[model samples]
Target: MIKTAILVDGAFYRKRAYTLFGDISPAERAKELSAYCHRHIKDEKEGACLYRVFYYDCPPMNKQVYHPLLKRAINLGQSEDYVWANDFFKELKHQRKFALRLGRLAEEQAHFNIKPDVMKKILSGVKTIDELEEKDFSLSVTQKGVDMRIGVDISSLSFKKQVDRIILISGDSDFVPAAKNARREGIDFILDPMRSPIRDDLYEHIDGIRTKAPKLEKQNVT
Candidate 1:
């Protein structure tokens, strides 16, 4: 019987899950992922059993802020974002077979940058520089220690021969080296992109790719 390990990139899964599964709650999403993963394992190998599921994510960004456009003070630490994230994390942690590994967001300056379309409009005089809206600027939050943790864990598992197969649910190419090394160590690496488009080079490193299909809702009989 093959022992299978599943690694989920939480941020990627959250975003893609909404697109693929429609407007489902975070708890519902987590439940579906866990169920789907186990089913996939059983279907792939006749007697395969799940080793563990690793979930990687960062705690919600809780920062004090003021919007320049509205001249309003906002406490992100007390907002809906903060509440929902805490709830979501708690739900995942309560799952029996899940292991949650968290990374963190670094404190950085949120500099202003115009959107590409806005810049083009300014150049063409369709909109003046003064006409730019607050939406044109986006605050970029940098993630710290995520990729490092992933690489380290993969290396640790591969070297110890902990599992026969590793399935990573991520679309980022940063994992190429780790994937190659895992394959070299004779661990079958499979990728579950969950319907996202994968990079061309990623194809060469993985043994297979698969995703769980979303079920459609039935219409009410009238």
Candidate 2:
């Protein structure tokens, strides 16, 4: 029984899930997420026990508006414009839509000013000739709290010897320091990026790295 704990960033997982699959079921998502951890168990730790899965996410500020808006924002299917003969401006248009929806949500729900702040941060200093672009603000919101939660949890678990191995399912670099500290304390740390490409820096430092199997892609559960 390999003792493993999975710390998942809910927002990261949800966005990736939607990208890889049309829609994701909670049950299936949990199953897939856990299974990915199981596969990446170090060969020597065959009987390690899986301790728990910790999922961190902000409660939907406006569930009614966020989901549909995010979906539309991410999907921008454009055909090749024979007139301009350029690659479909997919990411550009998608971000524009995302920014617009974020702005709407902010206005309606008294949340962050999605449009103005997003522009200030990601789309700043763009000239009139520049093509449209989108900015990723999801990570920005999660930066302070979520990273803290993950770090504290990992440290607590390691100090208490809660599990032999701890697995994190996120691509963010903020966890690197925590993971490094965990390694220094003799707790095995593994990185699971769900479906996103795991960066070399993260991969090199972890005791193990596992990605979702191709079978997960076939499930089409999202």
Candidates in order: C-alpha RMSD to true structure: 5.1, 12.9
Residue runs of model 1 more than 4 Å from their true location after superposition: 66-68, 71-73, 110-139, 213-222
The local lDDT score (0 to 100) that residue 163 gets in candidate 2 is 83
Best candidate (score: TM-score)? 1
For each candidate in turn, the TM-score is 0.83, 0.57
Model 2's TM-score against the true structure? 0.57
CA error at residue 135 for candidate 2, angstroms = 14
Residue lDDT tens for model 2, 107-134: 2443222355445645556532133233
Candidate 2 regions exceeding 4 Å error are 25-45, 63-144, 215-222
Give the C-alpha lDDT of model 2.
Answer: 0.56
The lDDT values for all models are 0.79, 0.56
Given candidate 1, what's the lDDT at residue 61?
Answer: 70
